[model samples]
Target: MQSTLYPKCVLRGLATTTAIAAIAWATPGLAQESEDPPAAGDQVAANPNAIIVTARRRSETLQNTPVAITAIQPAALEAKGTLDIGDLQGTAPNLLITQQPTGSATANISIRGIAFADVEKSFDPAVGIYVDGVYIGTSTGQYLDFFDIESIEVLRGPQGTLFGRNTIAGVISIRRTKPTMEFGAKVETTVGSFGTWGMRGVLNVPIIEGELGVKFFEFHQQTDGYMRDGFTGQRLNSSNSENFGLAVRYNPSATFDATLTLERQDQTSKPYFASAMVPGDAFCGFVPPGACGGNLTDDLYTAYKVAEHSGFYKADGVTLDMEVGLGAVTVNSITSYRDSDESFYADFGTAGLFIAQRPQTYEQFSQELRFAGDLFGGFDYVAGLYYFESDYELDQSTFVFGAPAGGIGVIGHSESYAAFLDFNWEVFQDVRLSGGGRYTKDKKEYEFPLILSDSVKKSWSKFTPKLTIDWRPTPDMMLYGTWSRGYRSGGFSGRAGTPFSAQTPYDPETVDSFELGAKTEWLNGRGTFNVAGFYTDYKNIQQSTVITADNAQGNETIVVNAAGAKIKGVEADMSFEPLDGLNFSAAVGYTDSKFNGFIIGQPITRPDATIFLQQLDYSDVDPIFAPKWTLSLNGSYTIPVGEADVTLSAGYRYLAEYDQQIAPDPALYGALLAQDFSATPFVVPQNDPRVRSDAQNLLDASISAQVPMNDSGAMANFSLFVRNLLDDRGPSFAFAVAAYPNLWHYGVPREPRFWGASAGFEF
Candidate 1:
């Protein structure tokens, strides 16, 4: 497949984006959750038109919940072609999902002013991703399918006391549809741009009516990439994936219920397209001719190469949950286990001149037990004890094509134990106070037989607390304030690249958060408005820096901690139904963050194949992945067309630019760091290294119709969607290579415009 690119503008914008992202990556890894999931069915909201979220471990309307959160349901996901959390990028305020140049599976997600940017097996996630209430342990495969999902909820800020460890940034909670006692089957298919084709199906079985039931879902999809290898006339970034799952539920009585779900996912794809690139009008003295023309960020590669033939990912998991009535209290249990394996290779130079390899395997198990009930004076409480364990192994390697590779192998295990309790009391008819706390103990171990002192061990324990106060002036409005503390456990950067080992583990990062908010409803149930402001005092910030050593082996990397950081932000979302059949929603956010102290790190490479440190000043760097301003707007209209209801929807998003500058000119880099390292640096005349990515805006639209299917209340629906309707493009994440910065500078282009049709039936 060939892509239609707006080269002239893209090249100009690509330069700025690449520089800023590079700086961000080397900074903190804070990931507040992103996006807004759909509301839960018929719960919490008295208005009957509000989104209900479980962000606080209880059902409540989004507008009434004090915490900041966003939600999206399956309907909106299908219409927008959202297959995973990554696809929600831009649509959500202050949310950024940047795919690693290596592969989409290995990526970074930033919410608000926080991010989990570094790509390493041992690095813990600043943001916790939970599926069906089970924590996803690794970054190796978080970009998977969202088959048969009920909703996705993105919670922002420090939810330490409630969500447990490593939720310093926030959490993403995903819920799947539960089994229904009905006999039915349905299937949907779609074909679209880039030779893309897909099918999704669901089957429901009624074993004993309401007493016992089971449901099954499956998906198959394939797509030719948007780019092609000009050398071999083959597709690049192509993918094939399959997913299936089964869920069973048993409800013997009104007060007791149990559910078990088993699922598996597999994916195979060609590595991302990579080819050496140079600015238009720049001389291609050492590169191919066309590489210097077009000023393209994405290279229409002249060659095809992959050390691993085909990239692959595989995973399977099972979850069991039960609830039983114990006198006046309810007891609940959640147990789960998951395993995954992945291997992939890509061209580091985009010209296929260099090759890279990354392979990993991991497994996790978790168990939680909690009790909840209501007591006197409108006092409500929930208490739980939780246990979690995981094991991981990874192999990383990189080298020039047709040459020996330099790399490292890492293996490790982790364990966590925790106990928590939360209580809420209605002090008066219109005032409420809530308090919660959690204590956790964690331990980790990593071994590398190749290194003489190979084994690394670390442990930590902490008590996190939170307090909230709410006042309801009326049944339709609320004002709230909260104070909370969140913690992310420290770990060993004992990887193969550098000599840094277990003896000196980095300190855990912590955040002290303060927030204030207001949620209100007007015009009956047709209008909703919410606003929140937050400030976070972050300490012991984790950071990754390059360490260059020109020897028999290549460059390596190690991570350390910074003094601290301070972040302040505000967000607002509103929805209104002014017209009889029309609805409008809009959201905006602003953030300001500082490192709090001087920051001096090493220079980052353009090729990105290795981490080689070249002393540089980072004292004035902006916050990583935290845009100054974000805006989004969406609206939909529905009208009756004969016997069917037809609807039209449109949405738009914009992100204000933040600093993303680094070394872009090889000559300038040589003048800046090469000489300082006592090594020869490439030099050029009047070199310019300062670069930036401008603000970006995107638009999307969709149309759909639904018709009834007999008296059984079944329905068949069809829809058409066009994403990136304006064909916005250029650069999102751009960079230059260390070995050949000037000749190898390039960027990851945003997806081109895409149009597709979908049809599905439910009975």
Candidate 2:
């Protein structure tokens, strides 16, 4: 069957990529080198394909790393205008990162079909985010701003053995630029649409010449949001943020080194515009008779009568890293401490029918010690011990019609201990076998003073393992197969309405994955292609459900262990530089995910007013955010003009339609059917269009120029960039709430087209 979502142009591009791959595979000798190579005077003669990465806790070239990873460097990030983590959505295969609706710093990141999108501190993120070897335990600050970053690596599959727990989906590793013993400074400013403006500055100072150095950086930005309040005509989603950090590097001797970093971030933003798809009964009374049937406004970016409170977030962190060399072995230690406070208000109904304010404070401390070096003649090993402890307090208050309805106060604590070891052995010529294992123990405690009289505690333990075999037949080609197991820690529900629900704990979810991959380079080092196919057996899935509670005015969200699932996918990435000063890259991902045994209990009421639970089967439902097809095409060309160089770059991405919800509630449909016999037939949740996201085709473009000032290595750079150039106003996130007599649907639209210009001077 032909797909309407895939345009002809995209199909042609895909075909071209396929053809190139075929030719390179079928006839590697026929590949020709670029006639005109880049000039030697070009800034930094770094080879894109040979970029270094630390996917397995060791530095290795990207083409030689036996993992499915994408590394983005400073130059590419600048060309693509990637400012934050959310801007990396389409740059990788089978990866989606979006900021949550109410929380500007919270990121809902999905790798493959696994995702977790809750703001509560009790819930652990499926994807692990690491910065300079320190793990971020909460989602609240995972959407980090990019500045002075050395590289960002997105690893596609499970990284449990190396990264420890809560990495069943994948891992995002961000490495920051280290302090240099040199005197340098850089300053940049930006101006854009919607009253957007920003400035950033970086300074490096040599404290003790080659012994000690320090780097300081600061960034500030503000924007008048595109969304506006429908009633007051005031900006609803404006944002402001400030970030500053300092890093000190001390290398007194070649045998030992230490680096200390202190950082802080402050952010304030109004909530995203939540548009009511179907007005609830309470909201209907406030509107005209006919106006209650559809949305509140025709404009997707407008919210009617939303709360006026803005969200605020503040965070402080400190990290210390020390490394000691011991003959054939090296010892590394990392200690980190972080604290954060956040307050946000959300209006789901958009008409003040239901409003909730959440205030939270969190703090965490972690320590890690690792030893890495050559164990023997042909074997290398890395072992680590990790300990983490965290505590958080949350207060939530709900209001209905400007009157207090219900709320909950929660205190939570979590502790984790882990030990891991990995080794690589070269058993034969150009062939290696690698294996690793991690044993993790997690303990969680929860207290809800308002609902529960006593606190609850639970503990879970698991051991994850990984094995891989790779063979390099040639210097530029690698073939590997891997088997790995990973898990996500389980915990109690923090958003529970009743004491019983709050005390109940859920089991951990696990995934056993098998992958086969090939990394190859052809065209005399001008073209590179990598492909991986993986199948995962997912068990004990932790699924979140919202149900109406008899003791509270609002619904409660609970996590339950569902039966299992199967996920399989293929990912391919290709980069080619067929001509001098021109480059093209393509990334394609295809995933097929389905629940094997998903069963839920649906409460049904009889005519006599008695309620009974009925078993409902939803195994056929597709996983959320698991689009069947995702493709990205990017190209850039540079031309030397006198003493300056100009570069033009463009990118296009396509995402197939995917379901946003697990499945439509059968009880809600049954209730509606009983009210009216002529109601629409019950469509399968997978086929229901109401809960599905539209296929998206996004385009972005940028042009940059760099001019040299003098021989002192001073340069001026300027760029103009546009995101969402076509302005596709599709809903990025949506959900339906059962409101007794009706189902109230709410949606948050994607950002519109935005254009910005930036200029910077560096020495």
- Window of ten residues with lowest summed lDDT in model 1: 28-37
TM-score of each: 0.86, 0.90
Q: Which regions of candidate 1 are displaced past 4 Å?
A: 1-45, 101-104, 275-287, 291-309, 494-496, 501-504, 550-553, 598-615, 658-694, 732-747
| Residue pairs in candidate 2 whose N, alpha carbon or C atoms collide under 3 angstroms | none
Q: Please give the distance, in angstroms, between residue 333's alpha carbon in candidate 1 and its true position after superposition.
A: 1.3
Model 2 scores a TM of 0.90
lDDT of 1 at 577: 95
Estimate the lDDT of model 2.
0.78
What are the per-residue Cα lDDT tens digits for candidate 1 across 1-763?
A: 0111123223422443343334333332221121222324443435677777888776667766778787765676676665566667655567766665454365566677777555566787778888878777766566667567888887888888778988888888889878886788777888888888899998999999988999998988888867665546676677888889899998755555678889888888876543435453122344455544443333433334433346888888877777655545666677777777787777653454456677877777777777777777578788998877877777766665457567667788888899999888889887899989999999998876545365788899999999999999987899999999999888877454545443457889899999999988989878988888999998987765433334223444455676688889898888889988798888888888877653434444434445454434343466556788888898889899988889898889887765332233444554544444434432322212222345777888899888898888688889899888887665555544333234344545566788999898888
Report the C-alpha lDDT of model 2 over 1-763, residue by residue, as the tens digit: 1212124323433443344335334442322221222222121134454667788887677887789998865686676566788878878899888777756589888888888777778999999999999999988999988777888999988899999999999999998888886888888888887888989888999999988999999989888887766667776678899999899998765645678899999999877555444433335566423324544224556667545767999999888877665556666777787888899887774477677898888888777778888878879899998988888888889887778988978889898999999988999999999999999999999999998889999999999999999999997799999999998999999888888789889899999999999999888678989999999999988887665565555567788887888999999999999999899999999889888778765443344545544555568777777888888899999999999999999999888887776646433555543543322233234523445777888899999999998899899989999988988776677665542333355667777788999999888
